[model samples]
Target chain A: MAICTGCSLLCEDIVASFENGSLKHAKNLCRKGHGHFQAAFTERTRPMIDGEQVTIDKAVERAAEILKSAKSPLLYGWSNCTEEAQSEGIALAEKLGATAEATIACTTSFCEGILMERVLSGKIETCTLDDVRNYADTSIFWGSDPSSSHPRHLSRFSYYPRGEKRQRSYEEERTCIAVDVRRSPTAQLCSNYYFRLPPGGDLPFMEAILAVLDGKIPKVADKKKMIELATVLKKTEWGAIFPGPGLIYSLQDKMELFEQLLARLNEITPFKVVPMVADCNARGFNELLFEKTGHASSVSFNGGSAAYGPEHSVLAAAKKCDAVLAIGSDPLSELPIGTARALAHQPIIAIDPRRSLTTDAAKVVIPSALIGLEAGGTAVRMDGVKIKFEPVMNSELLTDEQILARIMEAV
Target chain B: MVSAMEIYMLLPKTNCKKCGVATCMAFAVGLLGRQKKVDECTPLIEEKKYEAKLKKLREVMAPIEKASETGLIIHPEKCFGCGNCVVACPVNVAAEPTRTAVGLGPEGEKVILRVEDGVVVVNNLKECKRFGPSGTLCNACTATCPSKAIEFV
Candidate 1:
């Protein structure tokens, strides 16, 4: 059995046969994951210094030298690696008096932290994906498009398949709804049930839904549709709302409305909110930060002082720092180009398995082993389930943990 | 070489001085010979005229947008049909099928990168506004490739 690390789903059911030193027969891998697995054979980065291939020891020494010589350094990108690696990376950040962050920019500020904190503190109802598949009768994709992001979502859990309780399944048991700006794949799957909102219109939509849930007519463009959707929600046996980046980005400072909506829904029926994270271990990082720091992001342990706030986030800290150690992520390709350009100009150390825009321009490049394939560790699924796995393939390259450990030692 | 209407269309869109340029119209003039992304019009895209004027705006902003050939191909067989790819895709390329999967592979896992005669080809790659393909090789999915079968060429 193969494990796909393409996204956070970490789908464990895959069949593949090796032929001619390459994967030939494969089943259950998405296009993005296919590209990821194939990356092992193409554009593999080497320990490099100033664009020339160097020994691992030399590259590590150079990275340490850069960090040691700098007054302020930023260590980023832990969402792709394991908890063990993340811990080691954090220790290194502390030892070097540097600021550390995850792949996505101050993601917690975006709302996963708020949700996780509530979940951990018992402010909301939640369930595993397995539970949703088996028992959930109503699925709501709020500002989320699982189609392109978590491709196997509907079939594996939320909307498809006949589970223990959901005997009728897609035909009679399940009802799916999508709320997003675009007519997303998930929305298309939901067909007529799809509801489109203008960008940044989530709050109004939520208010409208809340109004309908209360039997009051919503003051919005489509009052009738809102009423119908609210009716569906009011009558749901088991409901779940999957919130994505769109909702978070739109309701940056105004997530209390979401909390209110969830509270209102639970009054009528069982409801759960599942955050749609982009990476495999975002939840893991969220869990760790929630446990260790009482916050989900923008945490710093510098000079024996731990400061956490939005001001300490990567987006803000990157400008104040002199050096950056980015691993397992390509913020250059992911963030606004301006942020990417700023980080790119700084003395940078990039650790990744494959070539990326960040690695290409980085001053120090350390190639780490692929997780779940080249390395083994534990990760937290989106629903908060901890999954442990062993490497399916052998590799001599150092895992992110080993690399971070070495950097910590050198620093 | 420009008309009054074209000049009106090029009026500055935002008062935000993040661009250092005073008015959006000044920024538009600066963008005349330079590369400017649609997102730069942070305020403009939100206007009612956006969709209506997109054709003309795109024409005038031709120098700003880059062209690429590669697009995403969905194989219905391997796709779990969770629509993660559809959402995570910066481009609005991966979409839900108008029809249901009658019987292919597993119920959800059978979704494939839509392919063509022996070669996996993606349609409307040109129209995709994302920095990469709608099905861009983000490798987010590969990070979870359990079978290790998902490959990139």
Candidate 2:
């Protein structure tokens, strides 16, 4: 049994088979997971320095030398690494007096506002996916398309299954509402209940919901639909709002509107918020960093003090830092083209299991065993639940934790 | 594998709204979903001119039931690669005690369905529990498919 690290869902029940140095068969894998598992065989990176094949020890020494000489070295891409590796990375950042941020810092301020402000502060009501399946009747996908993202979301927890309390399930008891910028696959599934918002329209749309909840006509287009949505919210026995990057990116700094909305909904009935985190262990990195430092992401341990703000963000750090260590994430592929170009100019130390743009451009490429497949470690689900798994395959490659520890030792 | 145009060709082509749908195309879609029957088309059934067409229509649609009884058919066009079917299978969870109850495959290395190119595909048909006579007729995937892309037939 293997856990899929393709996404933050961290789907635990995976049966994977390997034969002749290739993934022969795998069960319970989404397309993303399938791609991730297949990546082990295709484009597998070797220890390299300046496009030249090097031994692992030589690569580690080069990576350490690069970080050691740099005054403002940036430690990034912790979201895809194990919790153990993240902790080690944080310690390394502290020792090196470097700025550390995860890939989550590149987009979606969700970790900073929601995870740090509300969840860590205990200001918002939250529950696990299990609680959602068993009790949630109204599953609101706010600017989220779980169909394309967290694939098993509806079937396993949000809508489909007949839970202990939700015996009727999606047939009669459950109501799925999608609020998005366009008619996404999830919105199409919601059918009549879909609410199409304009780009950067989440704030006003949330205001409309709040207005309707207060028994007032919303100051937006389609007043009737807003009223109907309000009516549904009023009648909801148990509801959960799964906010994706769409909403988070839209709300940005004014995420308090979401908080106010959740507060208002909870006053009438039970409501919870579960962020639709992208990476498999993004939340784990945030939680671990939060445990060590107060901030969820974008923190710098420099001059014996933890400093956090936009200054420490990856986008900002990309310009200021001379050296970077990107582990388990490919910023070159996912980030904006300009940002990718900027990071490409820096001396990058990329540690990954598979080949990617970041690894391809790195000055030193150190291949590590994949977590949940070739290596076993702990990962936090999107909901902040800790899940541990054992590696499915035996590998000679070092785990991320071991690799990071070696780098730290060499530095 | 039958096209909507092929099903529409077998229709009376009368553009008759007696089937309660907008057009013959809509009726063809209904036929695919098993919501409307060929006999419901009064013109096709009563008119002798359409006798052979109706017979061919029935023959073409005959496999729907047997297919539903034997295996699950996933319409890739409707699928958005939502891992609903992958997670909803009991075989997936039962194969390993730690795994979730709803997911793709279990027992050995046979995968029933996999998402390819952002759409779901029946990668291994025989691996599904509903493939054989001793099949449990588990409709968890079909029941949970948000897009109704999966059908047991």
Candidate 3:
């Protein structure tokens, strides 16, 4: 059995079989995981420098030279890499006196927020997926569609399985609610319980919930529904709210409202919040960086200490830095087109296992072995659960950790 | 699933507004959503000429067994093709020749559930392990379905 690093779920029960030099079949893989596994056989990257094929040694040397000589360099894209590789990446950033940021930094300014601070300080309540399965009676998908994102979320933990306590499961016991702007797939599953708010209406929605909890009439168009929802919350024995990008992006600077809501709900019953981080190890990177430094998302070590701000973010660093060393992530395809264009102007050293838009545009590309399938490593799941796995197959390619160590050695 | 045309055929083509709807076609559309019942039409129910049509309409529009006594019953309309069942099923996962094969093609067929267009399709029902005489009742796919599309009967 092998783990699939396709998304943040990091599904660990994958049964993969290989024939000759290609992937033969894989079971227990979502569509995203299936695509990720198929990526190994199709459009595999080769060692290249200046659009010319070269040896892995030559590519690393070029990448090292670029990082060593460049002034105001930036190390980006650590969310997809292992915790070990991320640590090495942080060391490389410190060595070059450069700024380092991941894709998570672009979503919300989690660094300065009370949310990240509370998570780091362990002030806010959090529970694992197992806890959700066992104890939770109310599972709220606030702006997060686990059906499309974490496919097995309902089956494995949230809504479906018959836990020790939740023997009746979703039919008689569990209540699944979706608070989203549009009727997403998960919202559709919520059936009559879906709360449809307008875009950027999360603040008012939260205020309405708080109002209903306070026994005041909400000023929304649907006052009765809000009261019903509040009634459900008030009666919940154990509830968990999974906030996705929609909620985070909608509640940007007003995250205090979410905290207030959580606090208010806790007054009635036990409630926990688990952020719906996207990438497999985004939370891992955040936790690792927070452990090393005080900040959670973006930081710079140029002035002999860790400095973090919006200016040090990937978007800001993209314009200021002369060169960028992106690993395990394809920012060109993932980031906004303008940001991608700005980063495209600079000399990029892309270290990845597969060919992507970032790898296509990089001045230096060093191919590495695919994690989980071809290289053994440790990764943190979205819930901060540490999962260790061994390689499912043997590969001649070097792992990201080995490649980053080589680059550090060359520099 | 009964088609709108099938329901439309049973409706009296009077284009009457007595049912509050503008046309028989509109009434048939409402019947699909359970919004308008076949007996809602005053002329159809009261008039002896439309008795046969009304009887057939009621039979066709009647709710079927969404959940069975055993096995799985998938409501394709509710399935958003998330492929949760495809991955969560132990039977699909334990199948041989594990490589990455996507789409509805026959080669490298690993998963029993396939998402076509935007709905979940049971591609290989024969490969389902629950069908054998062992009476092994595995609803892993049905249990994990977030959309509640899969019903274990």
Q: Which candidate number has the best TM-score?
A: 2
Worst 10 residues of 2 chain A by lDDT: A101-110
Error of 1 at B22 (Å): 75
User: DockQ for model 3?
Assistant: 0.10
Ranking by TM-score: 2, 3, 1
All candidates: DockQ: 0.05, 0.23, 0.10
Off-target runs (Cα >4 Å) in candidate 3 are A98-117, B2-153
Better of 2 and 3 by DockQ: 2
lDDT of 3 at A407: 85
Top lDDT model: 2
Off by over 4 Å in 2: A98-117, B1-72, B76-148, B151-153
- lDDT, candidate 1, B24-132, per-residue tens: 6666665553434555666556667556665577676552333233322233455443333222222222233221221112223223332211112234445444334
Decreasing lDDT order of the candidates? 2, 3, 1
Give me the displacement of residue A319 in model 2, in angstroms.
1.0
Model 1: DockQ vs. true structure: 0.05
Docking class of 1: incorrect
TM-score, each model?
A: 0.73, 0.81, 0.78
Off by over 4 Å in 1: A98-114, B1-153
- What local lDDT does model 1 show for residue B11? 48
